[model samples]
Target: MPASGPPDQGEGKRRPLTALEDGYHIVTTLGSAATVLCATAFPIWLSRVRDNARALSGQSPRYARPWLYAGWIVPVANLWVPRGIVADIHRASAPGERLPHAVNWWWGLWLAGMPSGTGLMYAVPTDHVIERAYRQVYPLLAADAAVVAAVVAGVFVVRALTAAQRRRGVDSVRARPTAEATGRA
Candidate 1:
């Protein structure tokens, strides 16, 4: 059946994104969300590690940023936090390069997937089999776990690339000759 609602006239109103764009968005959004969750979780886990180390050494441990916890609980903030996390990931990955590829991927997915997912979820389902299957599967954690894993992998790839860049930067700095030695005549 054809769509019944009024047409969308937003930017690029001539037409909506193609199927490729929709797939890209879904995958990217999943990756971005996974990355953000992992990044935040890793830091918190490290903080716990720090606390344990400190306790073993008879020193006080520092806590992880409270914002990490805040991001998970707050609604609007959750969206914005992921963006910031991705930006930070990009920055951490490449000091001067354009935002990491993951950031672009995340934005692409989020822009396309979010609205589509919301619409698909809310729109009255006409197809019996699809509606029944969706209802049956949607509530299961397995579906969410698969999505989460894909997203996390996307974030991980970005992180790996960034770490490589940082390593190169460090190596170049270490390779530079001392001015005193270079000036010897």
Candidate 2:
């Protein structure tokens, strides 16, 4: 049987988490999953704001709500479509003002990091040699790190846009005009 309990914390000392079978991997996986899940919500909320702000300002969103979700899931198109969405939101919200530097930085990180993250995540080793796997881990780690950074940048993008909308006095989700209000059935 496999030795039970955390390994090598000394007899009286508490064992490390790794002592539990798969504990470290499970924790890491859960952390990564939670981080990605939280990151996913940023765009959804931002898109709602983007469209609402546009509608309030008498403009149409660059893409439909579905397109915003698609932009994240689609491969090559993700690179530009999402960026276009942000740019459109900025144009609508800020009008003549210069977009905050955060917008450009967020877009740049996303454009660059996403491809790198995908490449690293999808690249597989030809051989099972331990050394090769160890060597590969560094680049994979770097790419994953970049992906995390890009996720953080996404939040900054949302913040800047949200702040811009506030500055434009477009802070609320302006309700759609009713049929009666618009004089149509």
Candidate 3:
């Protein structure tokens, strides 16, 4: 019999990744890392803000402290819990005021970006994404747009909430009677 190369390394052997493929891998890795970081950090920040809002408004917390983090991961509950948490914060911070439009926009865009074909949740491999990018880039672009819009709206929501909290805090402080006024001096 004639000598032959290893069967495993012959016709069925995998080709080396191209530079572009390597770049895609790097981008995917970075994106996953960023997602993880955000996933971990956002809950902590939200928890703190939720506490502050509750204190400022002196209203009962609509959701428990754990929900600040758990709501994002729980199925079905995630659909409304996270939004409710933010809404509660805003409502508490600015009682009798309308909820900020940015809150609704942010949540809507964020939900719109969650599809596997479009948003951060890619059900396919990187190779598939690259392939799809060539033929159907619009879905990817739309997803990116949704995420970007969500981010902008989220910033507005945070700003509105912070400003409302600040105003509430100041008002509370001002409403308190001084020791002299209360004859406690």
Candidate 4:
């Protein structure tokens, strides 16, 4: 029978979360702004990255496969690509057995920011507007930003606490030992 008093009692003490988690969340939240920012920034970033890649490889810009081109330019597909890439990046950076909090933060802000920013920039504008209508839009957009900021901040707090718990050697607060397991451990 496995012996235990507290969970993770004999497992080597876990290290505190590295700064990477905090930095990753911050960068991701900003990057999620790319959905709107990307409407303006992605094409530029993509162009630069592509140009750099081509220059390094000495390859001419060849026609990309139709699906590849479509995946990037199409609305629904574009969202998925960036999201998947961010998740993959988070997965790569996280320690084994640790949940990828970075992925959660990235996805939450990315999904929320995209629709919120896009709605503010594209949907709210009208063919005809009253004089003060434009002025009102900015405040609405500011409110959206504030809400997103709160959500992102909340994500960071949860992630930080989880990391601290891990460092203190509580493997998982949600885990419950079975009757036999509890007696043995």
Candidate 5:
């Protein structure tokens, strides 16, 4: 039999979204934005702190601050580059202090989730088919789970290291000593 409306190709015709789906879309969009901000800010903030800590301690980090930001944005290098930069920052943030477990957890979860979030997983059908629909959905779910874990672990690492640095009396990594601090007009 012929289909009713415009051809949907293999998929069925689309229907108007219910209020729940609409609300879900809105929330996910906002949540995604927040996720992006946190993801970017985590590396940059840590990198800056690490840089300052290194400068104050008379030692240099293997990963520069700019690489911390740009590495994640670049292609072919993002796989391990950002994680390496963050690991370096994690190490340098607190001189002579052991890297926290949260750092390792974050790296592990990030590596686990990276493939799921990238071109490896495509959005597949959400139907209840055993092989047809689930192969795609499961990966996305796993990816989301891993990413959430990574973000939480990152929060832990950032808070712990930031507090550690402040307790050790490291200067702010804002690229300038303020007039009040410098005591200069």
Candidate 6:
């Protein structure tokens, strides 16, 4: 039989959340909502860009349109498909150019962050994570660093891809009049 006094004094009883814990909960909730929003919107944006890339490069897509979203969720395939998708976009946008380094860096760091404390924070309860943090902090810190690096690399990838597509579009427009003038259009 367990004897209870104050909640924190009891072996099995739960205590009221501290202000920091409460704030953590709120922040995590908001982060989760934002993640959902981004998850939904990202695939749509990727699909549009992929179509444009295909048209610009005159090459068929490496993966079908649906893979933009599924590639992230599917097991095993997830490891490579998402990277492939981004690579395809860059390749198509700049056919003769080498692939951007940011794409590889982003994917590598993203993968490293997963299966770390950062990923565990998303998978486990907040209380459990806070408790674990007291005992082991380095893993969490490393994970966070990886995730942050991934985000920075991801931004570079987006900029590179967007710029490549813009260049391709401008080149296509410039070539159009020439083709017509040469009776090739």
The global C-alpha lDDT for each of the candidates, from Candidate 1 onward, is: 0.44, 0.63, 0.72, 0.42, 0.63, 0.73
Top-lDDT structure, candidate number: 6
Q: Which ten residues in a row have the lowest lDDT in candidate 5?
A: 125-134
lDDT of 2 by residue, 11-42 (tens): 56643333333453465457567757765776
What is the lDDT, from 0 to 100, of the residue 116 in candidate 5? 51
The sequence of per-residue lDDT tens digits that candidate 4 reaches over residues 67-112 is 2345455787776764443333223223243445554565465556
* Two-way lDDT contest, 2 vs 3, winner: 3
Q: Candidate 6: what lDDT? A: 0.73
What is the lDDT, from 0 to 100, of the residue 13 in candidate 4? 44
1 or 6, greater by lDDT: 6
What is the per-residue lDDT of model 3 for residues 84-114, given as tens digits with 9 covering 90 to 100? 9999988877889999999999999988877
> How does candidate 4 score on lDDT?
0.42
- The regions of model 1 sitting more than 4 angstroms off are 1-64, 107-158, 161-185
Better of 3 and 6 by TM-score: 6
Per-model TM-score versus the true fold: 0.37, 0.67, 0.76, 0.32, 0.69, 0.79
Q: Worst lDDT window (10 residues) for model 4?
A: 125-134
User: Which regions of candidate 3 deviate over 4 angstroms?
Assistant: 1-13, 117-124, 170-185
Which digits, one per residue and each the tens of the lDDT, describe model 1 over residues 1-185? 11422123336442354454456457645755665776667555433323333333343323235644665446777666645554553344344767655555654555444432422333442233223333564533344444444455556545654354434332122223234435643
Taking every candidate in turn, the Cα RMSD to the unseen true structure, in Å, is 14.3, 9.1, 7.7, 24.0, 6.0, 6.0
Better of 4 and 6 by TM-score: 6
Error of 6 at 131 (Å): 1.6
